[model samples]
Target: MRVRKLTFAALAIATALSLTACNDEDLTGQADPSSTSTGSSAPDDAGSDGSGGSDEEGGKGTVAGTGSNENGEIGKCRTDELEITASDATIGGDTEGTVAVEFKNGAGRDCALAAYAGVDLGTDSGMISAERAGEPVDTTILKDGKSIFFGVTYPMNDSGGSGVRVTSLVVTPPDETKSVSIEWPGEATLPVTDGGGSSVKVGPMGSAGQGEG
Candidate 1:
């Protein structure tokens, strides 16, 4: 009878030990929710023209004009009503076309259009090319100026021929050559052609300043 009791006790002890081992195993080899990865491994999805890559991809925004320094402690100048007026552009049958570029001024100070403002053809990203137009525009600025115009080129629609995109219109006085940009109104609405006659405007692209909030 004692042996029977001992045998029953041993069986119970064995069952408890097995259960304890199982509990230990469950605790030690547990899968943790925090141990898993969560993110995508795909290629960076950028703008089709490879111009609209994210900040991580090294694309920020198009920079134009000098920054604002209202205090003038060697500060920058800013204007609220700098603008451009573009006429209908016609290209092809030649290596150029003609488009009129104008810089409309709304600043209180006298501002002239410099010789290096970019009137280019824009792409998927804010990439612009100096299309039919000639050199930098020359704005004739006076105090409370209005509009200044420059005539661009009339190039033929080559396969990779893009139309016209204006980067920036700037002004520099006689003493200083560093350009001060005229703020463009709205966004760039150019007509560009991919040398193959496939064309589109390069903008509504973002700028370096305030967010779209």
Candidate 2:
């Protein structure tokens, strides 16, 4: 009787094991056709490599839109800055008078002045000394003396045009956040030598030129 009981107990355990070894569907009901194979969860597919593609990437990377300016020179100093000072500076324009403007660079990168254009040495400060267009026009940095324009405001808008008299202008462009403005007064003298080789002297309106009436 003890041997039979022992055999019965072994049989019961084996039967339980066999039942558990069968498929889960067999234990419950019919297998769901639409159910995933292996009955495990599926993997996700956000697809993006998360590496943020390069600007010139053809397709492997996901490109994005960014803000940019055509005329903004706030970034690295452009090689063209020196050129603009010597000629048609969209930065500074228009001046009236025979005056000499010298530039002193304080630090940072190479740079020029952005000043008012067409500022006649004959006008008094109380009067509308000069007109400034949009923003001021910037001057170019040059190794030698630069021939540039100043103090005349135009129809458009820019940072390179501020119609105030400036002298001994010390421009510190190499600084991180540079502040561009006139520190001292710019003097206006009569034309001693014209680009056309004429001895044209400026007539002061009581306040523009040097001492004496």
Candidate 3:
């Protein structure tokens, strides 16, 4: 009975040692929540520091008409900075004729222009009305020494018994109040219906060398 107790006590001591080693192993295997990684890292945000890289693409970088005058925005063409001239009239047939009016930019800097020019064809009696022949083009950037042309077409008949002779032609550039006048180029005249107003058609402004008629 004493030998049996000694063997049982030895087995109990071995079991206690094994349980202590297992507890130590479990404590070592546990991870700290703060230092452990959960998943993949997040991506970085771009251009959040107010740099100009993204602002340029979004059209918010620099304001126009700022800094140097050369770099500033371009304004409308002024009358003082332009040279106006007209071509001789060419009769299409017995009924219609066309003449081209040219505007040359004489300014030291660039400017912008668009739309049809205002024209006044006056006879000995009174002023004649005119209308735009076609739609206006997009805004044209006129650099120094550049030019644009527009055409004016009118009735050329003088044998309608009420035909009035055209003597002078007055031209005003777009967005300008001042006007320039020159003598008529040809002998074209318009028919006056029962003393009513006569009409001429003007084309939209375009680059030089283009077909104006």
User: How do the residues 19-130 of candidate 3 rate in per-residue lDDT, one tens digit apiece?
Assistant: 9999997776664432343322211223444444577755542454334455756888888788988885564454677777888889987888767678889887788757
Candidate topping lDDT: 3
Candidate order by decreasing lDDT = 3, 1, 2
Clash tally, candidates in order: 25, 33, 0
lDDT of each: 0.42, 0.33, 0.73
What TM-score, to 2 decimals, does candidate 3 have? 0.60
**Candidate order, TM-score descending:** 3, 1, 2
Give per-residue CA lDDT, model 1, range 1-213, as digits (tens): 999999999999999999999999887666443243222212243343355544435522222122333323331123344544555344344344445444455675655433434444433446444422223333333335545444444334344435354555333322343544444332344445456632322111111121011
lDDT measured at residue 135 in model 1 versus the true structure, 0 to 100 = 33
Per-residue accuracy of model 2 over 1-213 as CA lDDT, tens digit each: 999999999999999888787866574555554465434433322223333333337442332222233333444332233222111122334443233323323234434333332232232232222323345433334223233333221122222534333232222222224423333333332222223522212211111222111
TM-score per candidate, chains pooled: 0.32, 0.24, 0.60
Report lDDT (Cα) of residue 156, candidate 3. Answer: 63
Stretches of candidate 2 off by over 4 Å are: 1-41, 45-97, 100-128, 131-148, 151-213
